[model samples]
Target chain A: MSDKSSSRSSGFDRRAFMAGAGIALVPLTARAAVQDPTQAAAQDPALPVEVTLRVNGQDKRLRIDARTTVLDALREHMGLTGSKKGCDHGQCGACTVLIGDRRVVSCLTLALAAEGQEITTIEGLATGDRLHPMQQAFIDNDAFQCGYCTPGQIMSAVACVKEGHAGSDEDIREYMSGNICRCAAYPNIVAAVKQAAPDIMKG
Target chain B: MRSFLYQRATDPGMAVQALSAAAAANNPLTQAAAQPLAGGTTLIDLMKLDVMRPAAIVDINPLARGWSGIETGGEKLRLGALAKMSDVAAHADIQRHYPVIANSLRLAASAQLRNMATLGGNVMQRTRCSYFRDTSYDNCNKRIPGSGCAAMDGVNRMHAVLGTSDQCIATYPGDFAQALIALDATVEITGKSGTRSMPFAQLHKAPGNTPDIETTLQPGELISAFSIPRRWPRSVYLKARDRQSYEFALSSAAIALDVQDGMIRDARVALGGVATVPWRAREAESLLKGQKFDDGLARRAADAAFADAKGRQHNSFKISLGKRLVARALQQASTMEV
Candidate 1:
């Protein structure tokens, strides 16, 4: 009975620790400013601009902070959490999405700037219940261990094949160098891209 | 990022007007109250870090329809400022006639960044100096003027060796500017007054006492286009970095040689990753001109390139590394098939 109680308390502590860690990522000054309603009201920009982003075959009309990036708009407002923000900065490609047939880091892209473009996220890669060929290929090739980077990798891989860079392993590696895989499942990722290239190119 | 206002400028005049309306025009371009948003790769990143706090952002991307073009015709190669880096790098004409430009763009950042970044923003990119980027370090003179430099005594493996001053030794971290400087490109600037052109070499100011002021542009000036005179068929850009790709150069060389028969008629040499600005090695170029290609000549040219290079404690390797790159690039350019 004592052991069970201790284990429950330890699990609660772990959960609290993780939540605290997550909050710590935001700067102290920003947190303070956000918590203070008066300061937040004063610091808020002129107005929350209304923007209509055509995301994943659907137009998402949102009124958000002008400073909001495409990545934030997708994840926070539209509930399209497929595009993960590994690094809010442009260093990591986890926030990569296709805008008008070109792959770009959505983190650096302002939501206002991407107003008219057709934005495609990882969530929109498939049709109905059928998984995208690239998704199927990733599964078949065992391309990931932790699936955190899989969405970005798969999104970048589809574009890589479409861009004619999937002709060789070297080409795929160079083209897909933008999306980094922390799991280092590069060999399998390359194989998966290779497997999906012909099928993706055919259509 | 601090928010103020965002406006879309469809024309050059409208953009200049919006930029000029903001206060603090006398401030350095980095600290300007208003900034033109192109790719937002540099501006957005810096703003998020609180390194740059522009109150107004003019969205100049709407002008890309008229500004994003690559015309390799007549005697000059005209590249519009808004042309995406990936588009310019993958251009067949650029790859064939000016491999230096193509390869420089190819080897920079990553495909996703290249697709987003424009040529204009790429050249105007700030240094990757940790002191400048991180606001926690208050000793950065580039960020806050008159503040002491932390990178001087701190870990500065990526600092500048050439054109460095006592105030700052932050390296200019761009590959495209080196090629432009080597090929003697001319930048066209659009302002409220009118359009004006200047040599691309004169665009970037070295980090002197006022490390804050980085460029020669006046307030509201925008880079409209870059024109390269004559074709550089035997040019090459070689970068040596910590990683194979997706990293800035430790040392790089851009060499363009005009060889007539067995002798060299003219040569252009520019060094990157070791300088505070896009450095033109005129001494090295003069050494190569009217001389036959040989190991001894290449060595002398390389030596002349780094004759005045001063390296800090951690970045001293760049001097020797830069010399070898200059020499190797010359050899490659001389033997490379046009």
Candidate 2:
């Protein structure tokens, strides 16, 4: 499920791009020593911040720009590209991921703020070739066409069921409204969620 | 997105101290040098669009442990500012006692956003006005003061009708805020100079002369919690939009009625998506206070609510739509099973 090739094809390496842009990799504590620190700090918005994110049961340390969102951290830095970036804004739910027990759009979540929390992308859902119930349900129901929004839809659906919002088809549709299926696979997506709700709830 | 220095604050005092450095600047609230990051739904999105470029971002999620509570045991409902919209909306007590608040949160955005967006951040969330959001159009008074408002003539359908000024007409885009204002909630603020409380209605400033300054909060001040005086189980929120879900309201109404033996004792009316702030329909509330719930009274109340509304070329329909919504919301609240 990891789209390493797609990540590479998307653009230049983030670290290399940052370096080429002449951004200073200043240590976080170093800002305190500067005279008129407020003015000095205000002038430098590109300072790199070190963050340790616990993704899929493993801790990954990243020294990236503070502006990096969880979506970029997962895709560009950690090579976990299952979560798509349909809209970098919160409008689209393609970047949805589980931060703790709740689902959130990763694009709006800053990587630096996500430290010490357990982050779960779509790639983390399955266990050793066994597809997660929601993912399997999506396939069984033909919940996707172009498959661009599958990962986010599945992630959102898993949360929706766990959140106890998948009791009815109307409830499922309302709960899953965030993840827009540009391919218009909503009916199938709702079916997939319905098919998986009982199993998900049982677990 | 421009670069920013990120620092995590373990406590409220630490967060204020970190933000205090940039608080001294005379910049507008939106352009504050340091911003407290709660849900990041607004801040990060605007940052990505280059609409907000704070020099520092203080991650205040660690303070959520102390600030995310939804306490209902007291005489007043004390909702911590950091409480997630979904958490508050789903809480049994909130749903049962404050249905307007719950429904407002539920009807807002998507499930994922509600899961992430904090109550404080939800109120602070900026407008969905395309001109203000997209930096390519450099004529937004809200984004740049005295520049101009392109939405005044171009694509003014989503613009505000009730609180429009010559300067700006960007609507306040959050549903939860209408609920707060309708309930007469009081906001508790924690800042560099300790804490202070104010009426939630006063938090947002209408786009008068200066559209840039959105809130009345001084630099380094953060909304710690909101206190509603009492619970109205008869309250309801009705939103009218293009879609059934995951869309901003075209016109929404939050109504809380105190009806005893079929006569209205008290009424609270607030409108959303049609005003620059969470609009409290005082005239409508005054009309409904002593009147019995009826279609005629509802129509009169709705008319009074929008009597002062000034709509532009494209958004003039909001005046009528807002009136209908207010009436419908009042009708629903009056008859709702408590």
Candidate 3:
């Protein structure tokens, strides 16, 4: 009877040991499972940024909380949607705009640092219905497919061609490498840039 | 996407004062705070991703005092901190004389960025570590106060091997800064106290245990000028990237030489994209000094640059790349009839 009782107690202890082990690991498993990607993304501590961006031709005070990109401000706050947002990052040229007169990745620029400067978005590229010369050449060459990356590609193309970077095919290729047309319309884009060089040069 | 506050200062002093106040306010009991606003090309992007959320931004571009002019006189060229990348690159004086500075700016991010960005802003921009950039999870001491550096061992293809410590390994990402360092440039800065001038080589510090402190820019200080002494015989800036333009360098070289009588009287060379700071290649400079500019001399100098390049597993490619950059930079400089 004593021996049987001891064996039964040992069995109870084994069950208790297993239960304790399982309980200890539950938090670790939960920790991994509960890690939210968005939450994880905001791990960096927050700092406030206040900037005044001179855009298109206006000086406006911007005190942005949660960090506002020049691209977001141009499209979201200012309601200028001509500059498309493809990759929110700096990889794609979909969000290209001019800070002073040169092309830059607006998506990468902080709206706070844009004070006292002229910003020219795609909407600013035309006079009423007349497009910039490069924009017209792009239309003539059908240099876009879905038109998602057109504004940025056009802006970059204008900058490249106008800057006399089209001195040679290699030079043009080197300069235009910044803009990527995922639609695979590179040949037409290059041709349109070449076509618009003279008018762009004069301008 | 979240809520925050913004403030703009009328000038640089106000900006610095605001920054000092906010930075000091780092919730001594909670977390760190405040950052100065420049061109916002790098920091703002991270903020949108919700990576950074400082309580306030001190507007610094208002410092008209920060932006000045290019003065060519007294054996050195002085570039005002406010000189736009485009302006500096397009300057007849800079291009005709210091081609390295012009070339570095020409190969920077993009034309639009050149117009928006100041020379001072480019030098002060943060590291380009993927982990530091990601709005999501990754180990980067620079981004997080002390989150433990995940990049020290993992996916460190772009991490620095030289001038790096166990606490941090992110590579410095400025093209023009290296050229400035090679040409023996000095950054001129002014603060609430006064003004200071230091060699560009000493501007950046190695990522010791304290990865948070990148430079010695004093509180309420603003860079006013970048000065380069004249008398360089030949100079070039060569950068190798995944593509041609508008991308950060994978590896790059900057070299300025004063050669005479089939021998180098003075030589200065610097390397970027491989170290924690603008790395001036002194051994290589020494090797090429008093020697003819030739393939043999170039190789010998190239060897000197890699002698101390201790790379991590993923970035061992930098060693070979650094060698190539040195050779290419030397070759390009040699061809220039200065």
Candidate 4:
């Protein structure tokens, strides 16, 4: 009787462990369910755009609404929130990202339009633990105060350097004017971009 | 934003047919059901603001294989509709032969926007008039016909000073169109019927009685390509804006000249930010022709350009700004080393 009771107790413990495991997985599963475009499309027939983006280095397949902007797709769906939504309009460049080798304001770019294209966001700038030279320069120079527009500034700075528009202080200021720093970190931001130009161009 | 249907077209003809089929089901006039999506900068921006509500969008990027080329052949420059603004601006041949074209594209929206926006979309870009963009105001004739123009009396500092009627006073709000109009570029359009070409000036209609009807394009028609017949090596585009970069022009000029032995053989002039359309200043062109490009001559030409310019209360400063832009543009173009 004791052996049987012990066996039953062991079975009860196993069940309890599984229940705890399921409770532990609740947040992760909820995030996946919310973010999985296929799951969302299965629930709602309205969103029909099946966009396949080669984001950073992964091929991310999403079935999003046709009106979903690249910025929303990156932040909301892909769980990459490094790119901020400052204005949602194209006026603010906080949502800037690199498509192939060119920089684009992702807020105005539709996810459906960016299908099958390579995208590089602020999250993609680091190599494992090491930060990109531009990101490092931004940090070293203290380019931002509030740090809202830094991602876009770094993204645009990388492109600006690659495009050879970082020859002078005035050129960097003119080219990087799209990414507005509301904290008024213009001089520091310019300094950061100039500091990183040589290393970014070498690559 | 409202839910909408989306379709990507592999073929341009199929895209037009799909739009036609959608428009036929509903009144294209009453309902903006189907729209061709190029660079969604303008359309999606307006959509999110609740200003433009399109029920279906036809993705035309698949046509980029055949439509995104920038060719300088056959004594003409052929720019494909789907070509990105930055790509066209950075083309060495275009920059060498057409400085005004390059300069116009360069001075336009931010670099990030230019990378995403297309040449076709740039020309078809709607006015940045705040009343039309902000839906809080109820009286935008362009947004709702016969609603009356709120910009007529309210906050019209950015409004057009020329080519404006009683119905609307929105500016054209593009720099590239000014260069196209000045150079006498032709727009190639393809529709259900076939391909038809029209002068770039006729592409955008002035704000007359019907302020809502902006472009003459048909429901299913798509702008295929733009062709500039000849190159204007001696040309310059000067834009006077509130800021030096990443801002729309307050007064901009695109001027091209063919001068021989210190005498002007031909001159093309266009004005932006002060006009309701991509304004070709033929009066200014006539004034510059056969005249020595001196400060006095340029001043007279500038005066002729704004001869009929009737400005509203807040926008009267644009007239003076527009004249100075014209005079300065002429001097710059005449002195350009080809």
Query: Which candidate ranks first by TM-score, i.e. highest?
Result: 2
TM-score of 1: 0.91
Per-residue CA lDDT of model 3 for B52-94, tens digit only, reads 6665555556664546587876678998887788788878777
Q: How close is each model in CA RMSD to the real structure?
A: 7.8, 3.6, 13.0, 10.5
Candidate 2, residue A17: the lDDT equals 70
Q: How well is each residue in A11-122 modelled by candidate 3, as lDDT tens digits?
A: 3454476677673312111111112323322332132234567776667665432345788778867788988877665667788887665788887665655555788888
User: Model 2, residue A183: displacement in angstroms?
Assistant: 1.0
Model 4, residue A61: distance off in Å is: 2.6
lDDT by residue for model 4 (B1-338), tens: 66556666778887787666566453333235667888888887777777777666777888889999999865689999999999998889999999999999988999899988899989999899999988789998888888999999999999998999989999999999999999999999989988999999899988798888888887888999999999899999999999889999899999999999999989998999999999998998898788777899899889998999998889999999999989998988888888
Screening candidate 1 with a backbone cut-off below 3 angstroms (N, C-alpha, C), the clashing residue pairs are: none
Is model 4 an incorrect, acceptable, medium or high docking prediction? incorrect
* Stretches of model 4 off by over 4 angstroms after superposition: A1-45, B24-31
The digit string of per-residue lDDT tens for model 2 on A1-203 reads: 11112222222355577789896556653222223435545544455556789999999988766667899999989999999988778777999999999999998888877778899999999999999999999999999999998999999999999999999999999999999888999999999999999998889
Candidate 1 CAPRI category? acceptable
Against the hidden reference, what TM-scores do the models get?
Answer: 0.91, 0.94, 0.83, 0.90
Better of 2 and 4 by TM-score: 2
Please, what are the lDDT tens digits per residue for candidate 4 over residues A57-86? 899987655567888889878999999888
* Candidate 4 clashing pairs, residues 3+ apart or interchain: none
lDDT of every model, 2 decimals: 0.87, 0.87, 0.73, 0.84
Q: How well is candidate 2 docked (DockQ)?
A: 0.43
Q: Against the true structure, whose DockQ is highest?
A: 2
